[model samples]
Target: MAVVFENDLDRDGRKRATASLMSQFQHAAGLCTIIGSFTFLFALVIGLIR
Candidate 1:
């Protein structure tokens, strides 16, 4: 148990942390892209209708 904990504390934990960071970054980027696209489309429609 201690060995497993130590391994996680050293290398494995770092990998997990990096993976989580990357996943969060991707999620944020996706959200931004979706929101930006929607806003752009909405503005375009509003402009055209006006």
Candidate 2:
């Protein structure tokens, strides 16, 4: 109970932080691409119907 705050400036933590950030960025990018494709397809279908 004496050591509640671990050191935050460690090598492993920094490496993990960067890796996590990169993966999260990629995830968001992929989601955006999927949504964009879906929206485009919906618009295309609607246009064709009209």
- Candidate 2 regions exceeding 4 Å error are 1-15
Q: How many pairs of residues collide in model 1?
A: 0
Per-model TM-score, in order, reads 0.69, 0.68
lDDT of 1 by residue, 1-50 (tens): 01122222344545466555666677778889999999999999999999
* lDDT at position 39, candidate 2: 100
> Which runs of model 1 end up more than 4 angstroms from their true locations?
1-15
Give the winner by TM-score: 1
Candidate 1: C-alpha lDDT: 0.67
List model 2 lDDT by residue over 1-50, tens digit each. 12222234455555456555666677778889999999999999999999
Best by lDDT: 2
Q: Count the backbone clashes (under 3 Å) in each candidate.
A: 0, 0
